[model samples]
Target: MSNFINKLWGSKSKASKTVTFGDSSFVNAPGGRIWTFISIATLILLWVLSSIFEWVKPIYWPPIQDVWSQFLVISSEGFRNSTLLEHVAASVGRVLAGFLLGCLIGIPLGFALALSKTMNRIFDPIVEFLRPMPPLALIPLVILWLGIGESAKIFLLFLASVWILALAARSGAMSTNLSKVHAAYTLNASKRQILFHVILPNALPEIFTGMRVAIGVCWGTVVAAELVAAESGLGMMVMVASKFLSTDIVVLGVILISLIAYVIDIFMRYLERRFVPWRGKAKH
Candidate 1:
């Protein structure tokens, strides 16, 4: 018994799998960085040239400077009675609220399903059925059920994101090493001990992956959800601007959302690295 525990606990897995990106390892390579910078700069230059030359009508695609000027103007003044920063904050708040809600409900439900075959058998079919439904499709139902309020928007985002996290967590739990579980059982480890020590840590990597995917989904869904009826948030701003043919503001709102999502994704990645540093280093 002692020998088994020692071997199980002290085992170290050190096989490092090499990860490459297609034909070129562009993740952090210097050449890749240079090429990326050049590509983006070239794009900007082309945009500026097209705008200057009037290649396309200004009404359809405003000049880069016009968009930049609009951004600065809105940053200093306000947009639609609310400041740019306020719109950004409102969008962020809704997304976080929805994402957290989904995570809270989804993760536990997933773990439960993984731990109990009865739960899995009962709920798996339902989950699979609902998982593919688009959040946009639920907008009308949510509005009818909850009204066109923040709750409706939050619910829509929650619907968009919950299934992803739940499935990822379930997959992680299902993929746990059967041999290790049997060994733990043979050692007479309590259910609680096994759950905390063996199950959760092994599942952290998958949970993080789910979180990344869920957040992106939530962000995208919230934008569309806000379009239903919102006075604030970037999506609302885009919709309102489109009605008035304020293409520059619409473009600005899109850029802002994209930038915020990118930053949030980076933060999530950092958290994943910090919390699950042993993701690929686990000893089987």
Candidate 2:
């Protein structure tokens, strides 16, 4: 038993090599960085040129300058009785609230499912059933039950994220190596220590992956819900602007949402790296 534990720890220490992106290596390469810049610049150049040359009507595709001017106006003069920042804040708040709540409930439920056969047998069917249903399709029912208040919107966002997170957690926990658990046992580690140190750590990477995906879904769900009925939000801004054919405001709202989502994903990646630096390093 002592020899086996030593062998396990030695192997783990030797396997401390960092993971690399392989095919996606260019993402961090200097040449790849240049290409990214060029790609974005080309699109911006085309947008500007299109406006100057009138390639597409302003109604269909507004000039970048027009969009910027509208942004300044909305930033100061306000849009639909609320400033641009307020709308953004409203949307972001709903997403964070619902997503955090989903994580709190879903992660434990997932761990329970992975650890207990009874929990799996009971909840697996319900999770699978709900997974296929579209969050948008639930709007009518959500409104019926929760009404068109903030609760309704938050509940919709919650539904969008919870199932995905639950599954991610279960997969992560189930994927923990039995050999590692046995090694812990051989070292006289208690079950609680093994669960916390071995199983939970092993499960973190999948949970982070699920979080990235769930956040994106929550953003989409909240926006769609706001479009249905909300006094404030980026989606509401877009919907209200469309009613008056205020294309620039609509474009601005979309750009803001996309930019925020991108930033959030970057943040999630940073957290994943910070918490699970050993992820992908362990040899099977």
Candidate 3:
């Protein structure tokens, strides 16, 4: 995970370090693949056994089939006056709206902060003040100010995701190679030319890294945002189900959210690999 993160942010150290990770040939070996399958199978087998033996009450941890049946049932009969798809759509829509809005504004602001001392001095304290405050903590104020509408939820999620992205963008810009900047100056390149051609290229990796982090942070706030007030969302579904002691549905909601977050993260990583394949390495 650490290696993956280092790769994502292009963690260029002061010295040119040649670090070799474990070879793919070894990791992809038949033996390694067998262990990987075995690990996953073992967990599934344990879950089946526990469910069969009633190690825990069915109410708390239902059998795999029960969850599956519940999923099918929800698909057909709907949950809390809405279909499963509707619930998912509600949650996904809110997250995307909030996340995209944050990115649209936060990314450029972060770069500006890193590039301009005046901008940094003006906004740094304000961002810092809010960064450490949990989005949930602001829920009451948001409700009072924005009301308990969709805007409140989106705002909370925006706050949840924005700070990390801003910080990442700033770090990436600051990490621009000083020697390269000086060389550009020697070549009589204007500040705007150097920023567009040199700094942005180096900072792209970190900007994307922050985006990845921001997505996770936004996801973390999904349930909290919905819990405050939501008509239809996976979070709302989970909350409503829990009211009837339906742990299966709650767990199912959790699994679905995890799956969605995982899928998005994978896509983000693919984008990073495509755009900045030369991560955490010095330029030739």
Candidate 4:
């Protein structure tokens, strides 16, 4: 009887091992895809139900179908005699131009402040005073100086983005490991060599983080700038829709802005992963 019991237990163990290691296709099932589909379907259902129930009335909450129709109409008919493609191009051009300009100035200035004590002392107080003021608050001055054209809008965007980016770069530079700097010096490395090989690489992660934050801030400022004075772009579309009580068009504009921001954030994450592989591994 003991022999028979041992045989039964041995057979059970063998079966378990087979299930664990042999032909286990179930372990590779696409759970992520399933969850994504379910989540999207649930959201659509909820949106449809909300619209059917007249839940957000008086304030002009449009249904998903209406928003889709509005999007189609805009795609077909255009806004302010400008095609959707044209508006998108204009907005994207402004953002890239302004963001690039901010980076060019902010990065070098930040590095200077970080490396030079004299410069830091001279500029830090002035920067601190200016940093607290919102970019939107300076719109009047921006308009007065640059006028109500593309120049003013881009200027506002640059102002909104530059300070945050500069501060980030300075912080990154300051926070670079002192031991690494000392080690580079001991190894007969020049100051430029130390900065390029030791400081910049170590501070790269922080710089990327700063860029992400700056991108979001820039996006918000773009919308605000367009709202204040613009004949085209997503913000202008929303403003026009609001004036005419076109809730569907307004919703479409809001969704498009959100979608664009989301896409940009995804691209930023890709960049972070590609450039900061060490940081990614450490996170896991």
Candidate 5:
């Protein structure tokens, strides 16, 4: 037993050496960075060339410079009377409220369904029935029930986000390897210990992925919700801009949404990395 323990604990002299700094790894690390920059540079060049030759009309595809100036104008005073920040704040607030509500309900319900067969049997049918209905399809009902106020917007965003998150949680819980659970049992871990220390940690990566996807869906749905009943939001800005044929404002609105979604995705990814250090570095 001592010999076996020593062999397991001792480091072998023939073990592979770790790579040091100033090696080939550094060269490989920068390849992805260079490729990303190149892609952006190529797109900018194409945009400039297209604008110079009038390859597309300004109405349909405005020049980059015009879009930049229009973005500044919108940022300063905005379309109609509302400023860009006000529109952004309103949209973000709605999404946050709805997303928080969905998370509060979805995460616990997901765990319940994943853990308890009885609970799963009870809720699965209802979830399946409602999951197929698009949030936009429920706009009229939501307005009628919630009175075309913030409640309607929140409900729509919640509807958009909850199903995706619930499905993700269910899948993650189901995918946890049985062997790990068995090992936990062999070690005499309690149900709570198995859940918190084993299942939840393993499920976190999938949960974050779901949240990233949910954020994108929420952004898209919030715009739609705002388009229907909002007085001031990025979606409302685009709708109003369309009536006046202010393509620049519309473009700015689209860009702003993209930026916000991108930022949220980045934050979620950072959280994933922080919590799931075993996941290693992300590719991009």
Candidate 6:
């Protein structure tokens, strides 16, 4: 089993690092670093100039100082009787809960469809039928069935994530190299052993990839759900601010959502590195 495991991991003495924006080489590259700095600086310079000179109406593009002031007020005085932290927590909580639940069900279902012809035949049509449908379109139906509550919000997020994850898992499992399986069989490995030791490891990279995508989808779905109706959450805060024509607050909400998503994706990539180090290392 140890030998097989080593072989499965390509028998490397050390795992090669996956390329990411934060990777040392990428960050340390003088040309790339300089270009990135210039790009961001130029954009910020333009924003400041536009705001200072009133190139755009303040209603359309509030000054950066105004956005900062709003943030300070909300952080201390709170928004809609809920603290800013509470609003962030509410949205983050719903996203994680729904995404984790989808993972619990979707990954296994994907494996079943990939590994068993009977399972594929039975479930494929249903999956195909639902996969292309938009999560936004289901809001009314979900409200009818579950009402405009936390359950309804979570359900929408779950729907947004599940199908994407299922497809990722199925693609990963099906992409496994047949030669490795045949070799395992020749070595008298039990079916259970081959399935776990061989297939699961091979599919993990794809599963992680799917997870990244699903989380983004869940984030988008949660905001839309909250917009439809919610007492507290980032989306609700944004909706309320927009209604009042508070452009600064609206911009702050958008920036917060984008930053949160970016951080989560970075964390996911870190996990992928730790668990599936051989990912992107395999020779085609």
Best by lDDT: 6
Cα lDDT computed for each candidate against the true fold? 0.84, 0.86, 0.85, 0.78, 0.81, 0.87
| Model 4 Cα lDDT, one tens digit per residue, 98-197 | 7878888777677778999999999889888888889888889988898899998888888887887788889878887788899999999999998899
Question: Model 4 segments beyond 4 Å from truth?
Answer: 1-38, 280-284
Local lDDT at 267 for model 5: 84
Clashing pairs in 1: 13-283
TM-score of each: 0.85, 0.87, 0.85, 0.83, 0.83, 0.86
- Write candidate 2's Cα lDDT for 1-284 as tens digits: 76555543332345444764455533422322445567889999999999889898878878888899999998998887889889899999999988998999899889988988999999889888998899989999999999889999988888899998999999999999899999999998998998899988999999999999999998777768796589899989888888888888888888999899999998998898789987776778
Candidate 5, residue 276: the lDDT equals 84
Candidate 6 is scored at a TM of: 0.86
Question: What is the Cα-based TM-score of model 2?
Answer: 0.87
Candidate 1 residues lying further than 4 Å off, grouped into runs, are 1-32, 186-188, 282-284
> Whose TM-score is higher: candidate 2's or candidate 5's?
2
Report the C-alpha displacement of residue 5, candidate 1, in angstroms.
50
Q: What's model 2's overall lDDT?
A: 0.86
Q: Model 1: C-alpha RMSD to truth?
A: 9.4
Worst 10 residues of 2 by lDDT: 25-34
- Give residue 203's error in model 3 in angstroms: 1.3
Task: Return the top candidate by TM-score.
Answer: 2
RMSD per model, one decimal: 9.4, 9.3, 7.0, 9.4, 9.7, 8.5
Residue 13 miss distance in model 3 (angstroms):
29
